[model samples]
Target: MSQHHAPRQYLNWLASLGLLLLLGLGVELLLQQYGLRQQQAEQQRLLAHANEVRAVLLGELNATLHLATGLASYIPARQGRIDTAELEPWLQGLFQQGRYIRNIGLAPDNRIDFLYPLSGNEAALGLYYPDLPKQWPTIQRIIASAQPRLDGPLQLVQGGRGLIYRVPVFLADQRYWGLISTVIDFDRLFAEVEAVARQRGLAIALLPLDAAQQLALTSTPDTELHLPVFLAGANWQLQARLLNPQPPLLRGLRLVGWGLALAVSALIGMALHSQQRKTSLLLALSQSQRDFLQAFELAPQGMALLDAQGRLLAVNQALCRLLQQSPTQLLQRSVMQLCVPAEREQLQVRLATLRFGHNDSWFLQLLDGQQQQIAVECSAAILGQLGSASEVRILHVQDMRERLRLQRLQSEFTASVSHELRTPLTAIAGALGLVNGGALGEVPAAMRELLQIAQANSQRLQELINDLLDMEKLLAGKMRFEAREQPLWSLLQEAVLHNQPYAAQHQVQLQLLGPPCQVAVTVDGQRLAQVLANLLSNAAKFSPPGSSVEVAAVVQGGHVRVSVRDQGPGIGENFRARIFSKFTQADASDCRQKGGTGLGLAISKELIERMHGRIGFDSVEGQGSTFWFELPISVTKPQDAST
Candidate 1:
């Protein structure tokens, strides 16, 4: 090879190495950011999972405490001896309901007097609570503090690790009356948490703070995360570790970087060989520019490049055709010059407000070469970084003429159809009512039922027409709401009373739960009553004979939750998605049997929403369903009304 060729080859090699090094550094930085983000995400996930487990454990513990506290309140304190034989039935039933409780013991004077479900806890029977040296301190604390205490994950007398919850019983005047100890199996309690950790490929350990190091239970792990577990006054540590740690994100990044570097090196070698043969680099540069121009011109959308000062830099063929102007005529002109005179100021204001790398859009009228105005949606985006001299902006224009025209046509059609149906529907309903009321003449006995049926059908048809009109008005934002602050209890009672006649027809009673309270909410009284009536009518219709429909008003945070609960065949999953949609029904056969326009819920939803409230339901296929709505509480407090 010639000396000149050798020097060029060496220079190419050095350039390729520098490019590879830069690529490596870039990949490393990206991988560092990715690793940091992954660590944060992992920590968040661990905390969420740990809290979930904590909640479950707390729920179980609270249930036992509730039962024990309730039982303690029931048992009377006596001077001599207390008979626990008669209490066995209740204790046994309570013990059966617990998920992890192995035994429940009632100790009077710190000595076990009664223990239920003694099969696996026989050794714990008739034992003195304070005699157990290992757990005596925890028990003594419960007695001294007169509060419930949690003990163990310790060695139980019956063998195996279990937690004991001790609730100190107290009588009148702070007299201590024995204690109730609910023993929960540690292994069973953590079964769900362990299973979840296993599924997530995490190693977990539970270490009691009071226990020796040798007693710690763990899944063999690598990198560990420690979280504190505090339950019922017992402090414990929950350690989550990775069983099979993953290689850092950097590993894959490095692999990709090396592969790209190799490809780039090969490309550099090829380019160098081409350079030696074809030494005119200027021709290659010109060819690349031509390729870019071809791509820009062939794009479907109009493209206009504007400098930072908003003067046009380049215009593509599409843009030139859109503007009906030649490249020579439009070159170096202000982009704002294309807009009509009235829109130029607005365009200048929008451009001034735009930040680099952000987009802004507005509607404007543009003038063609012939000076005719055309409607267009203009979206502008600033390109490149702030304070860069090379930075420019791009404008994308779309013609909105067709879309606006179609929207106008749709609105006109809906309004006209609704108006046309209203007059005829009112006439039909009035005529049917007159005929059914015998204003036309006395009807024969055989035709009476048929007349009644016709009247009902006509009423249903009228309801459908009304529903359609209301829906249209709601969608068009033409409906008016007169809202006021009213007594929530009064509203609930009125709705219940109104629905009583309907409920009686179905032999279903409407019972209101909870005492009357002084709670007020701002709402359109008539609209809210209508919503409640619709819900009640549904509940009564679906309930079986002698079944009671429960109406409740619960005070939730910032709102009052009103619900209508019915014991009926609950909603099917298939119908749930469109439950609030117009013409939706749980069963198509229901329209015939239950007699509805299938628009009650849809209309009710609209009415509630107009009053700024939310409507929803909870259902189990076989159990029952509860349809509810919540309205924001009124700022004013009202006087309590008697039930």
Candidate 2:
């Protein structure tokens, strides 16, 4: 009877194998369908976003063109000696209707005929702001083509932000009178793309003129993402990628759900007919075990099974390929042997933190068989195998050395370039400051104007250099903080006094308020002074003559808080988000009209943080802005403290 049942058992096992194969096929088919659907949905969403942005941009472009054409016709009506007093105010009103528009200017005859946030029609009536100064070729191109072009990832003449926008204008019988362009906050607009992507849990990046990995849209201080991303939507290439892992498994299960029902029904029918239920169940268990083994061996990542004591129990083929060594040589090695000698202890501690059932992922500079320090990311899980009494630890390691190397190189290059540029900038700025301050003696109006231009550009250059340097330091973790005991109130008073004359020159009232006592902080004196100076300078720049700038410092929550409030045209809500961003000015027209580089607030923020402090600001449009920062309380260092 036993011999007769053997073939029957074999037949039952084959049936189970057949069911497993069917299940596998169903899973694959379902996964494919799911992936296809996901791709289609993503594509549709991207297309929609692109269309929306395109529509908005087109509307803005058309609005400006209509306004410019209207303004240009007025110039001809007045026989080319246009009086902005009649037309500029109307254009300013047009600009105020759009939230994204920073400032709009109408330039005629290759000069700024009128530019705004009109104190009146005369605000920049005769002033040719460099950023808004007539882009003659651009105007000619528009006149020549009448077709709109996205002119930049260039700094906006208005707010000093890098931009890309639509330009269209009017012409008289093929003569380029002037052009109208809309300055879009390209970065912020890109964020809108990111926000949509984020809603769907995706990664997004905006490339510079079709070059991805140039700069990132995300706000992380110094992340260098080098991955290539292309968005088929928007006709604008994408520098962003989004990843979601949940769908693949969900799709597979959908397929498996269908197949499992059929297999189970078949199994029950066969059992009832042949009296082979026991044999079928055993075969099912074996097939399941075999499938698990296949998944393990063919894993995409390097997989290693190590004992509780850190000895490698087994290395999969993936692991062998990664380490560039055979499994035989790796068998007795400790998990720590894969890491750099200095980092082994940390890895061991992290590994020990893993309980019998848990795991975590972390990154490190690890050593491979070639003895190279390669950047690697490891994810580990503790598992229990039936043959082993102790739980085994499985780790998956992937090499990220290339990515790390690229980031490091960028950081180093940024630092080197900043330093190289600073020397000349320092000399130039000092010269300009001296000339502007009468250190170079009295000057004629023409000479003074020329010097002013040079001085302004120098300041812009300095700001850019400083921003680069600060970014580099932040990236390299070379940012140094100096904290020392100091009278906080006294420092605030000193800052106000130093800026007093400067404020008077701008006709802004400077006031200081603080108790005549010691409210000290442990912070860098020079850096603190810099923060205060920058705040005061910005206040002076924006404040109207006769308006007051309040400077106050107080002890709040065991920290020293200082603020500078300016009564001026308030910061617009649109520009507030990037108030601390480098190389960005508050308004498009203001950026080109005013001479200061846009790096001040960014530098101040970095400086304050390095001094164990934080900075912030508050503002409202047409009401002005208030800037402030906090530093830890001054403390007495004991003699035993290490240097």
Candidate 3:
């Protein structure tokens, strides 16, 4: 028997070794994938940084070069004549505005004629362009092409390295005049670029495309992104890379993966060689039970284990504190004893169903140790095999008193504020109306216009307050509706007439279309009219001037569908989900331009739903939108209504 078991032990060892190899391979593959993703993300980030640096460099170069162009334009407007008194101040202004300009020079007939601030730049004065063999060809090219060119990060006669932006001037009759050269301090400009790169922990280089202009700036290796920079008829390449390319955390993760594989393999091998399989299994089960008990004890909500008979097997601390009872006093006690007598029978019936594998949740009132009732939401589920003698159930209870109390307080506050503001607003509106109507005597024309404006604003404010009150009443379950069978056509006609003046104010026409039919629906007439008015006014406001808004109705199966279509910019994809939310507008500027409190749609939706209907809309971004609502048709037909 010992010899036969030896081979079985060797097989188990071999299996453990194979498991280790598989786990190691999987971990290595996962690490490689993660490393590749990190490298790609880093490259993308570096590319963005390189583009930003290129834009800043180009912006600085263009701004400095614009001064040269401005001077060229100014010289020609003066008919190719440069006056010291007029030209000095202009050049001084340009120099002060341009932070990176070294100096400005005007070369007439291919010779340096005038220099701004001749203190340090006196050496550059009276120098002929033809005398400098290196720059003469570039200046000649600028004059022939009649275009601007940026050249040189070369040594300047005035001292430091500088770039020259040369703009050729011409007369009104297209005669060649001279060149306006603006010297830019190359070192100062690049200092700013370097500062930005250092802030992002990146190294950057700028390489000119022209090989003849061999001025290249570079840093370390490991190039990541190469972006093009175009300015003043010259192209250059910008390269960027991260300072610390590889992160240390990735290396640490690789080492951790290998160590975990080795540890797992050694544990399995030891377990196999022990020859006490039952002892090892028991140890694992004990550990799992301990973990579960620790989690149950620390849970925030009340939790408990109950036997098949509904007696408490074990209770966590949260449950003990919730009931104001100790574990010693609550052990083996029936959980139903904690509920009020009025609800105990119902609770028992629900708990009995848990054994049959039916999970349930319901609201209940529990009595604490002092016999005080507490409102709670309770749920139960079977914890073990169904119908087994040792089966247990888990119960979860959450207190709901605080949530209900806060809701009541919020509703009361909204009602109080809306009522208080409506009274004063009504009085102000009435006074303005009387004054504008000449009831207080003949008024000046200017004062009458001001009074009318005040009246309009007061009216808008009053409408907003009314919408708030209606919304509050609906949310509080206090809005009363008088439902009756009514013809939908008459309601639509009344809404059209009511909103005609509003549509005319926005210069949009309203058209009522569809085949004539006597479709009646059971709804509150007043509320239904309000919903129609909201859709009509909204469509009219958004429609372009002279565009038409169409109101139509159709019957489908057992419901009547009413639609309001408009020729207006449709809703955006991002804002469509929140279109009916409280105080939400597609754009904030729409509130001031379109004149709304942003609560119209929300109130309309609530009112329609309260009247037993559904409201929705369909829209394409640029075409337009159609708002529609459906209401169940009344059982009483039109002919029956006449009876």
Which numbered prediction scores highest in TM-score against the true structure?
1
> How displaced is residue 450 in candidate 3, in Å?
5.5
Candidate closer to the true structure by lDDT (higher is better), 2 or 3: 3
For model 3, the superposed segments whose C-alpha errors exceed 4 Å read 1-295, 303-315, 323-397, 441-453, 589-592, 639-643
* Deviation in Å, model 2, residue 86 alpha carbon: 33
Better of 1 and 2 by TM-score: 1
Task: Report the C-alpha lDDT of model 2 over 1-643, residue by residue, as the tens digit.
Answer: 9999999999999998787787877656655787778766665554454444444444554554454344445544555455657666676776766454555555564455555554433443554434554444554555467565555556643345533333343444555555444454566655565566566545655453344333443322111222223221112434333344233334223545556776667678977867676778889979987996687678877888778888888777877887788888889888888788888898898888897767799997766688877778898888876356487788888777777888889878878888998998899889788988897688778888899888877877887777678667764667776667766666777788898897888998788864543566777777788778888988998888788899876668767678888888888778888988877787657436454667778888888777778989888777888899887765653232111
Candidate 2 regions with alpha-carbon error over 4 angstroms = 1-337, 340-363, 370-372, 377-404, 411-448, 466-483, 501-510, 539-549, 556-558, 563-602, 614-628, 637-643
- Ranking of all predicted structures according to lDDT, beginning with the best and ending with the worst: 3, 1, 2
**Pairs clashing in candidate 3?**
none
lDDT of 3 by residue, 562-597 (tens): 999999999999999999998888777733577787
How good is model 1 by TM-score? 0.51
Model 2 residue 18 distance off true place after TM-score fit, in angstroms: 43
Instruction: Report, for every candidate in turn, its global Cα lDDT versus the true structure.
Output: 0.78, 0.67, 0.83
Expressed as tens digits, the lDDT of each residue in 493-606 for candidate 1 is: 888998999899999999988787578888888878878888999999988899999999888888888989999999999999999998877878833577776878998999
TM-score of each: 0.51, 0.41, 0.48
